[model samples]
Target: MRQALRQLAGRVWWYPHDEDPDNIQGGVAVISDPAGSVVVDAGNSPSTARRIQAAIEAAGLPAARRLIYTHHHWDHVWGACAWPEVEIIGHRAGARILEVEAQRSWSHHYLRAEVEANPRLGPSFRGRAWAMPSWEGFTVVPPHTEFDDDLTLPGGVEVRHVGGQHAEDSTVVAVPDAGVLLLGDCFYSPPLHLRQAGDGYAADLVDRLMSEYPEGRYDWFVDSHSPPRSRQSLRDLIVSG
Candidate 1:
């Protein structure tokens, strides 16, 4: 956990779901520049939302301006209920996750209480669940603002919708001047543990984003898991792919 925190600069932060280790991961980022800072993804609990809010405040950014839903997974969007004022953003494919998969994942967990009771769901995340993001009883809101491709995104910073990787709505939010590109789970490091997301991941999305990220041009690369990578390494992953 400390290593993950160290990976992100002071400007970004995250909150973990104290459940089975592999259960859910919460990530949120802040970019307090011109276009304005934005929260990349909401976590599982209101405390997580509050932590993200605290991180944003610590970074000296606004309380609420933009909220980005990398994907509509339960852990990613469930906590947004904590901040109803923020404008949510995501790709159309992600919108479907809200409308469809969000509940499915929850039902899978809720209905599988026996599976969870049997053995903590797995050896890795095995433990008494503390605060897993439960959509079991909450409102699921669709992305208020949806873009297909190449959007004039906001975050107190200007970002371009680079290309698709995670899902059809997957977009690489790039702050050109900062050279900081938020690769929304495009390259899931083993550290960013999860089963899978609709048959996407590994080198597929990572390779695509790297190919389009101006090639050996970015100054910083941020993902939910792998911390930040220098331009050389960022391009190398793509080049190697």
Candidate 2:
């Protein structure tokens, strides 16, 4: 599927997630400035990454100089290798997780064996992997730079480690100048494939996120798998539910 980049703010552009036959790709955000573009998350595979790259080029945006991961999930970080020249950044814990993943073999047979060994493994992910046409060039690329709590890159892009129920390494990217927040799945419930208990949201984490970057702080909130919503809308969804 050819995904088109949609502008969320003056300097921010994102494409929605694509559910292809082989891979269920996550949404990707691009923050462009005179310096260069900073991609929020790499997609599901190299092909997905290329689609993102193509969209950026088509839009005449600056080439991505850096790639920032929201977490260590396969759908979010597997495309890191595709942007070899871009510096990859992520939370320290996420980097560690990716490091371990990088050591494992990702062949289709190996993945199938893993799924067989652990039924709790993501069934949706497993099914998609089984449908993939090829696993060629598929490898986990650990972040080159790791930060603990928060880091602000050039052009006022702020990255914060706001670990949540979905993943402990969950992070949020904010463009203060643009009034846009790139929430890479941090607000989502725990993976349904895990059959996790409870409501699937860490109330404390949600409170922390709101306390830090509260409503009215950002005009647009972009989740990895959902369409952009107003800050108040997201706050209501997470806070009231």
Candidate 3:
């Protein structure tokens, strides 16, 4: 699918998630600043990352200076190789996870073997392993800078670690000046592959998000897999879900 770069608010632009493709991917956000753009998530593969880069360039946005990872999932971080010049950043725990993932072989055969041996290696893994155009030079680049709680980048972009059921290293990025908050899967329930029988939302994390960034605090709530939502809409979905 030809995904266009859509502006979320002021200087924030995002490439929406694509579920139509065999290799489903998550949304990627870009916070444009004079210093350089701050990108959220590298992408699912080199091709995906390049597409993101192309979109940014096409929009006349600044080149990416820093890549912020919401977590160390393949769909979110494996595309780092495409942006070799950008400084990568993420949660310390997420950095540790990527460090371990970096050592694993990404060869098609190896990935297939892994999925067969462990079902938890789920559809996400299977799709990336078999559907992406090429894994010939696949690489995993962990964050160069790590933070435990939260960090603010140049131009008032805030990244906060909000550990949850989706991924323990999950985080949400806020461009307060623009009234935009990018919730990188932090609000989602654990994927079926990783879920226990009664696994549900991480109550503490949900409470934190609700209270810390309540309605009116951010005009747009951008989730990795969904379209941007109104602050109240997200709150309602979270509460009802």
Candidate 4:
């Protein structure tokens, strides 16, 4: 439940939940322009999404005009329902994955039961502070826009289907004007094996960026589960992975 928000670059903000082993929440990024704002990866649930929404308002930005999902993971897509009015965008594969998840009612129930069974989740998830989002009547709000490769938003924010070791539908969003990149759990934290896309593709993306920006064009690289990482830090991860 503990979340913190900070500015990473001009008109770009980072909101990350403090690292908690038992109950993890996805981090998010907000990119704003006079036209509107884009929210990258809504958090894990309604409560977390509400906090993100509040943070955006507090930062004096407009309500999110669009939401970009990096993949189809429940932690990333489930919160789309919270901002139904905003246009949701994601990889075509991710959109299909979300439809499948919407039908997996049993999976949602199982997750809740698992959290309740684990004592480590007591304070944050099982206790009074927070609870697993009720799945009874749960439904997904699928992404309205899907792309095969890459798409650019109004403010030079680019979302590319840069598949990675994380998932086949993984996306990498870049706000070039702000020198910020958001890599949703793709090449960041690893079991390395979880990546459905080969490591080579992931490496290629990093290599291209590195070559294109010798002096570090991107100041911050964000993952859904962690804080903003430096350009070199992300490069190190890509190399090591």
Candidate 5:
């Protein structure tokens, strides 16, 4: 998937999921600096981490000094264990989710629910369909650094505090000066995980982003499940502009 959709927005690049019928996006943002390169948001799976690393290599950046998880969710943080050398960073709120949610969240939601729902999850899930993995081996670590409102990241990127509407710990990395928003599951085209438990908060988050940010002027809008529904939802807001 990273091979198929490696679209770059200045210092940041996106890798999308082509194999997924759901068309979710799991990407790494590469922002280069003299110090080194920083990759944002580790992908959902180990395979995804490999692809993202390959893409980063293809982009011609040296080994990344750090990786940042946009938010702490199974699809986002699970793969961090795949990349050990890179120092991970996130907001305090996100850091807690990584630590507190308990691997139980991962077991109940991802390993159990999704795969049992479909075999496309992988053929390895054949007879052990009901079998689930334990998060016992998993180690959840908090972000080394936490920020309150807005923080300027390398490459002139602004990591903004998008507090309301989305998950209680949602974070939005906005290149406001550049008109790009690296939203982490805030808004997507067909609506990423729309049917999940946080539908009401998710809906509010959608309204906030659409009403707050500018329209197509932004060069790119990136998200974990960055879907077309995001475009349409924001387009309505643009009309009011």
Candidate 6:
């Protein structure tokens, strides 16, 4: 039960989903510069979106002018409905996945299942029922701009489509100046060493990441659910995987 925005790098920040049990485990990242801020991933609900927005404002940073969806998971992109004006960015396949999930009312069914699975959180989240935003009221808001290959941001940051083992639309964002690379659920850590993409894993994805981001290429490496690591550590994980 914690809610705090952590500054990871000079201009990078992370909002750990702690206090809100319903939105637990879905963290959000933000990369800010003079131009504006780029949000790595949105959380599971509008309340989470508002919290991230407040954190950004409290830090005296600029508005979240750009959003990068790491993948099509509900926890990652569901918060976009709160800010329809922002320019969302992600791989084309990611947009397609969102569309399918929206049509099927994914969030409602998913939350219900989670309650049935975990009696602890099933009781309530922040004194409320463990429920997500209404599927009808929620929209999958596809990326305003979609990319097939890699897209270089205004500040030399690169968002490359490296879907191999994770979701086919999985993207790895690299901040050249900051020497930080963000891997969004492409590589699962710990006991669950396999990729968590519902679509299944792609064996060569790790090899591709290794070749693209060798040692010394990045100083800090961040994944969707794990703590940040050094360049060598990340590279080794890929190799060992």
lDDT against the true structure, per candidate, is: 0.57, 0.83, 0.84, 0.73, 0.58, 0.71
Please provide, for model 2 over 116-199, each residue's C-alpha lDDT reduced to its tens digit, 9 standing for 90 to 100.
887677576574474356877767899999999999998889999888778899999999888887888886788766545566
Global lDDT of model 3: 0.84
lDDT of 3 at 209: 72
lDDT of 1 by residue, 123-195 (tens): 3232113344353445567788887765665433444454443444545666665556776665543222344
Error of 6 at 192 (Å): 9.6
Order of quality (TM-score): 3, 2, 4, 6, 1, 5
Q: For candidate 2, give the lDDT of residue 146.
A: 96
The predictions' CA RMSDs to the true structure, in order, are 5.6, 2.2, 1.6, 4.9, 6.2, 5.3
The parts of candidate 1 lying over 4 Å away from their true place are 1-20, 33-36, 101-130, 133-137, 154-166, 189-205, 215-217, 235-241
Which residue segments of model 2 deviate by more than 4 Å? 19-23, 122-124, 127-132, 239-241
lDDT of 5 by residue, 4-26 (tens): 33446555556664445443335
Q: Assess candidate 3 and give its TM-score to the true structure.
A: 0.94
Q: How far off is residue 224 in model 6, in Å?
A: 1.0
Candidate 4's residue-wise lDDT over 1-241, tens digit each?
6555678898788888557655666788888877778999877776677789988888788789999998887677666777867889999998888888777543445556756787554433332123344654346767899999999988788998877666789898888878777878765433332323443435776676556544557677777776677877877877676
Winner of 1 and 2 under TM-score: 2
Candidate 5, superposed: residue stretches over 4 Å from native: 1-5, 18-25, 101-138, 176-178, 188-217, 227-233, 236-241
**Residue 227 Cα positional deviation in candidate 6, in Å, after optimal superposition:** 2.0
Candidates 1 and 3, the one with greater TM-score: 3
TM-score between model 1 and native: 0.68
TM-scores, in order shown?
Answer: 0.68, 0.91, 0.94, 0.81, 0.67, 0.77
How many Å off is the CA of 208 in candidate 2?
3.4
Per-residue lDDT of 50 in model 5: 67
